[model samples]
Target chain A: MTNQKLYHAHIEACVEAMNACNLSYVANLKEYNLEKLCECIRITRECAEICSFTAQSLSQGSQFAGEIAELCAKVCEACIAECAKHNNQHSRECIEACRHCVEMCKDLMVAA
Target chain B: MTNQKLYHAHIEACVEAMNACNLSYVANLKEYNLEKLCECIRITRECAEICSFTAQSLSQGSQFAGEIAELCAKVCEACIAECAKHNNQHSRECIEACRHCVEMCKDLMVAA
Candidate 1:
């Protein structure tokens, strides 16, 4: 696939992962664990934002692609760690998605 | 402040930063740059999600806190790089917020 196509695909994957995290948070809301749920929401949102940005940066050949890649790795790691806490199916899926995105971001970073 | 408070505050900051990024993306929509705008939206959303998760993880002293911190750093860096391209007020603000969040995440990672 072309570089642009790859970047777009990566961003879409990240978005799916983040959406999974958000859904998990919402699902957990009824447990009155607002604190935990809220935190998850925040992290997932942040990851989604940066993932989107990284895809755009790559598509445009932005000068900051390398820097973005570095950040993407860190964020994905953080999200996975957070989701790992629940030991539930949703969290597990989130962890997997985050790991996938992290790897992609790292590859993009290297290429940049 | 207590560690819990600190974690909460950090999450809040990250949420704010991600929100800023999202708003920027929306603002740029009028330019018919769906590709760039969509990418930014996705990244901001992801960042927000992960930031929320990290805060919760730290609050609960999850084993994954360190991992989450690492991820946060990577995502923030990526967001900053992406936003740097616009040279507009919103993008610049997002970049600054992202940098601040990255620093916070790094500190959390070390502490974890």
Candidate 2:
């Protein structure tokens, strides 16, 4: 894929991850056993924020896009690891989105 | 001031900066002299995103809050520099907000 195509794909993946992580974070907060899911909630929220920022920076073609992508990938990986410990639907979705985001971020980095 | 107070203050400053940057970015996009304000628009958008993410991360007490704050300060500085070149009301507000954010970020880092 062209660099432009890779950029677009990466942005899409970041958005997807952002949405999923947000949803999972909210869901985790609403859980009765909040203590057990504290890390999950925190990581998911952090991942969502990073993913959203990365997508916005990429859309603007900002000079910091590469740095933002690197952070996004790292956050996504952390989110995936945390969410993978859970079996809920939201966590599953978050993990899947985060995994996709990590892959896209790597591809975008390579293309850069 | 306590660390918690500083964190809350930093988050507030980041939110203010984000709002100002977003407003300035949108206003710049509507300007007739689009070519001259292109850098202003781009930097404002990037600054807004970073400020937003930094605020969210700080609010969540995320482990990466420090890193996000660093990036937020950097982006806010860039926005301030770019907006200072423009003599519009929106740019003025953006510069003020970004300057405040940078100060708050510095304080938070020192407290850390």
Candidate 3:
């Protein structure tokens, strides 16, 4: 079984990213007519889903938790890149959350 | 932009998989102490998350919807394999949902 204590920070970051991405997704979805924000909405949804799954896997001590963390980090980076292109508060918060998640995933990978 | 009409069945299957996986996850979580069911619980959560994102992207006509569908199909397959090992109502439903999702994803991919 995996140890949750060791990856607590990583899990927290992933959860934070998930929440931020979900908020951003909903905000962007409302403005669906905006062509420029389509990619942002899509990537935010992707990031949220992956972060949610990664957080759940870590919390449950799944055998592939580390691999999921790696994938989550990659998606966070993509979310950050896309969200950065927009200047809204929601995008800013999402970028911050994704950045933190990436850092935490890096630490978790190193610790593993 | 991706056309939702072309992939309506795919989106429907993804939603079905998502709902079934969520149900299975909740059902198995109550029995989290059962080591044998842990994998099922974890995979169900994974499948649910990916299916959710894939459905949202397809509904929104995201440019990368096809790619997401591909990933969703792969996760559904994993869920099917893991859930198959367990013989329970939740697992059975998950397996059926994932199987349908995989078939729809395949059709969507070919059409794309």
Sort all candidates by TM-score, best to worst.
2, 3, 1
TM-score, model 3 to reference: 0.52
| Candidate 1 chain A, poorest ten consecutive residues by summed lDDT | A29-38
**Winning model by lDDT:** 3
What lDDT is reached at residue A44 by model 2? Answer: 86
Across B1-112, the per-residue lDDT of candidate 2 in tens digits comes to 1223236677667767876787687677768989999998889988887877776566555666666777888889888889989998989998999999999887766655
- Each prediction's DockQ against the real complex: 0.03, 0.07, 0.03
Error of 1 at B16 (Å): 2.1
True lDDT of residue A112, candidate 2:
61
Using TM-score as the measure, the top candidate is 2
Q: Give me the displacement of residue A42 in model 1, in angstroms.
A: 18
Share of native C-alpha contacts between chains A and B (below 8 angstroms) recovered by candidate 3: 0.00
Full ranking by lDDT: 3, 2, 1
Q: For residue A100, give model 1's deviation from the true position in Å.
A: 28
Query: Which parts of model 1 have CA positions greater than 4 angstroms off?
Result: A1-112, B1-3
